[model samples]
Target: MNNKLISIALTGLLASTSISSAFGTNISIVGRIQAEYSGINIEGFSSQTTVNDPTFFSSWGIRAFEDLGNGFRVVTMIDFGFNTNGGSIGNREVFVGISKDSLGTLKFGRTHSPFADFAGGWTIDPFVYTTLQATGSGGTMIASANGLGSGSYSAVNSVVRFTSTTFNGFSFAVLLMPGDADKLEAHLGGHLGGHGNNIGDTGGENGEWDVQFAAKYVMDFQSHKLEVFGGYSRDNVSSAQKKITAFNLKTEEVGRIGGVWSYKNFSLQGQYDFISKALGAATCSDAAALGAIGDVSTRQCNTAMNPGGDGSIWYAGGQYRLGNATLIAQGGMTDANKTDVFASRKSKSFTVGGLYHMSKRTNLFGGYQHVDVIDKNSIVDRDRNTWTVGMRHLF
Candidate 1:
């Protein structure tokens, strides 16, 4: 069948199957489109500004719930990524699950991990603001090992996820990914390029297993909201016989604590994170091994550079509502231990933005941001500034 026909058939099947059931089912379609223009200037460097490409700029989601007898239900959500500029499909999320008011929900498929969901709540001004752009430490840390990417803490492939229903304003979620441990060894050889000859010469199949877990709690009291979350992930690689292992198995743990206070039309919020060490194989062998001669050769070769280290991050922001318009401003920074190879970078950023409610499901927004980076190691000049203006529509 043609692509269009296939899509039509699948959608029809979903509708028919859902409607034919004894339980009543409801389906809702929703999504958003955001178009933005941004200008950036790095201190000591030239400045550039341009409109953002709308690819994946606009997306849609379909969520359906079947209400079974006695408070039981089946729920499924599929979100499609699309470009606003060209209107094309991007990546997509598909999942199926069973939910019960007292028992919670259990889902199996590709979905967001607990860690990613928690970060979305803790990170101030996410998707709505322009100043905060750090990718690492924000969400799922496990996906970084594989070429496969994750948003905050989302994971693809195969997963079993569980989310508990709120009990007195408190809830929790967990996700598990089951896979072969030997995959880690495969990456060591392919990416690091070694054959298990020396400590630095180990190649493919450095057997290792990957696992991640996260838990979170939220409480709402009158005018304030509190959230506490923690996440742990490990990637362990076993060295081949006769190979020198420079680093032991690697593990990372992340924790976050935050709160939000609201009064009248204004809200204030803050969050902090503590991260443990990260480990990875070296990129380059001895300088000489690459055909360089003399003192360069004497320099350390094939040495692993693990950027992981202890670090903390925090940010605070406030928003005030005025009729159809809302104003927002926030600032945050991250600090890492000097053991990190990527120099300890500190950022101070603030954003001033206003949102205009076009309608119940649509809004127009424009914002400006200023960011300054303080580099301790002189890795690069210590400054970056960004200015952005954007609009969003929801359905």
Candidate 2:
């Protein structure tokens, strides 16, 4: 049944691309394909390095738009990623937007948050989501109740976003999420009210409302270019919070800041993420105040009892380009000692690589990376070494 639906969808796209020309719509096919020999090495676990998957796979998208008289137009882009080695489509998305020359562009559908965009989406790190990330894969490897290898794609669904046209190299955007499994974050505490005057008087659960804001500026220094970016966001817990009888728990707030610089053929980039601020007041602990609002007591509401602390992750990288070849290196770390009872658990990784451009649409690359992870509970450390060489082509 699923295969049938997919075929219909692809056929629909092809049909639209063919007929849209009647309305003077410009449609284009765009994407890239990268094939590589990727391998990994670990201590104790004799998992030797092997060519598993490349840094990227073959994928293409269709984007179309038609000018509507004035400086306004209607646009739509549908894109997805697939594994050529396995013959499976992994990430798929579609978005429609209305753009005007004077105002800005408003897009509605599944899309990336402003944070991911400013950071370069899947390619945010030096190794481009392949390495140098928290759990690698651009930090997609998250530990959840489902398992320890949960892969979180970067795209967010049911989102409406607006990006202002650049003005004086300054641009800003706001992303509104209707909450459909896109990194929900719930904060505890209000600014003026609370069950027990916690962290500035805001105590109980802050609404399940989520919002994110991003701003950036690019400056030209004649000899070089500098771009600075910053983002702020508030999220609701997870499905667990919604299942917490009446009141699970939510984090307070989260934010990030970073910048990048480029001079001639050399560039540098880095960013820091401020993990959730578990500032919720455990109302269930003070039953007299929370009443049966907490209905059935659960660990989700035991925010205070849990490892409540602020966590942090940071990455720094630089690359140099000479002629048609480029060199890259980066280092990153994540510490959850403050938020997890298993305090002091941390991980760090380093990566270096080189890429040679064969043409405007093709490139050859090779790289190596190493990661060290410390498990607080087992007091055991795990290490991973990775290497890859691949070819990429764009159309």
Candidate 3:
């Protein structure tokens, strides 16, 4: 009887140890690669250029999770971006979070905003070639004004966020950041109904804070699907002599509303943005205390401010599967408010692409995109195009 009791106790101890080891931890790695060719055309210029190169690269990520049990977990992910064109590694994302099935998830670090989730769902091009790329948020106008050679505004860094899991196909998310907390208590000031700019008047600090929120719903009925996403973002800038001298503007709010619908193999998506104190309007002189053409204009500045001078974008795309191959086509347009220096700039692009599946884990692809820009003022005219051929593998 004594031997049997000892044997049972040992079995129970071993079982408990195995369960603890199995439930306590997990890890994973993820990645992607891409390649492309690009070309550019400027209005009134006689050059149609070509950028043919082995561009785009594979990016990898390391992710881990710890199970706290009782419906709770701790998670972390780190991503490294590699340049196939330049042969280098880039740090992309680093974040940590605590998650509970019932309570939701809270994360801190650099991550894509809820706004990206709402705005990115409308296209068939994972690369956004034929449609406005996620980085094209400011589009051509802001790109030109800022002298940003390759115009794209896809992500923001240094954020704290909370996300709620899907509840009946509905969910919500919010992101926040502390602007120049050490210099001025602007977050507290905004909470107390004090003007954000006033908190740092007379050169206190010049950093800015951004807040964004989004809500989404996705419903499926057999072969048909519907998705609706909307978001708002506000950015407050501290008052400094540089800001006052550059744009005569201090703070801004930008809001977006959009949705997508799909049936069988076709989909359509649209989005509109209202910007307050538009950033495009602020202009700087090329040379001070002398006569020279400034980089941007005041008209562009005022247009950036007018709420009526908002921007709207729309796109429609379709895909048809043909025995291990899929043919894809998409077109999109962006209309900017005339009052916006960047608003008067308009663009339209179309693409035809295809994907060939080599197996469940590998694929080959190619696509062509043509883009045109319409300029209100002849001072700047930009027309660009690109072609991309790439392969992807998954494990």
Candidate 4:
């Protein structure tokens, strides 16, 4: 069939089907578009600014389901991402799965891990996925991307995922990804290379498994609510017999604890993470912004420069809603590995912002962030200030 004919057929099917019918198909189109005017100033460097969509924010997708007999349903999704500023379109999340009311939901495909989705993730951050988010930009969490052995991006690939039904305010989730065979090529760049492979050597992978596990609990009262969560994620990369790089990159591990409390018009949330062998995004960004490319070879944000050491990250924020607007304040710090290789990789950042509700599916948001990074080893101590004002619309 021609492309236009196929689209017409699908649209007709969607319009004719009864979404609530037990034996009929239900389909949904979902997405969001966001744009912002952003500016950044780095200490001792020229300022840069742009009017565009920030990273990982603009996307669109389709979700559909067919109800089967005996409480079973077939579900599927295909999502893609794009930059409003300038960049090639890319895949976001895609999956096929089955769900049952009493049993739970199980899926196989590429998507976010349990750690970054359910257990204790961006939910705690009011401005998640925005320029002021605490994960990749604020030094409050490990910025794991989808690589050969990585599993902590906003979405991951080749995953087997399961989430249990909530029972008495408790729920859990798990994700497993099998590693690929070693190409036998030397990886000298680092983790998350240009081709999304290992740029630097750290041995190679051979049928190893990466996993994530998480759980959450909730308590609700008439005007108050509370949610507590915890999770752990691991990226394995130590199966090959040959090790050929100096970056000493090993398996990455992260443990997180966090919760959110809401009472009437005020809400508070926070999270803390213990990270091993995974570089902090804030530290890496600071290095790159200061023109210290040598500090971060090949644009690998999660490279383990000091494989034997560990660090911690913590963030806290609160917001108050008044009529049509909400005010926000948040900040956090990342303490890098204590080894001499990263003795000065510590960073502290804070953000202040507000959101104005234009309607149920649209809002106006703006925020300012201040970040300071210390790198005694390279004598590159720098400070950065960023501000953004944007509007987001959902459909």
The lDDT leader among the candidates is 4
Cα-based RMSD of candidate 4? 7.5
- Listed in order, each prediction's TM-score against the native is 0.68, 0.73, 0.69, 0.82
Model 1: CA > 4 A from native? 1-25, 53-57, 87-89, 119-157, 181-249, 279-306, 340-343, 376-378
Error at 255, model 4, angstroms: 1.2
Query: Residue by residue across 2-111, what tens digits does model 3's lDDT show?
Result: 11111211111111111123656676656554443433333344433333222222456677789887999997777665544655544544789999987688889765
Minimum summed lDDT over a 10-residue window in model 2 is located at 143-152
Q: Alpha-carbon error at 202 in model 3, in Å?
A: 21
lDDT of 3: 0.45
Report the lDDT tens digits of candidate 4 across residue range 101-194: 9989999986666665675555556666566666555656555544222222245567789999999999998888776645323233332222
Poorly placed runs, candidate 2 (over 4 Å): 1-20, 48-57, 119-126, 129-153, 180-207, 242-249, 277-309
Candidate 2 has an lDDT of 0.50
Locate the minimum summed-lDDT window of 10 residues in model 4.
Answer: 1-10
Question: Any runs in candidate 3 off by more than 4 Å, and if so which?
Answer: 1-24, 37-57, 118-125, 129-154, 181-208, 238-246, 280-310, 338-343
lDDT of 1 by residue, 232-350 (tens): 54433334312434433244445555666666677777666555553432221221121111122111112222344455556677777787777777766656455623445454566
Model 1 CA lDDT for position 364 = 62
Model 4 earns a TM-score of 0.82
Q: Which one is best on TM-score?
A: 4
> What is the RMSD of candidate 2?
11.6
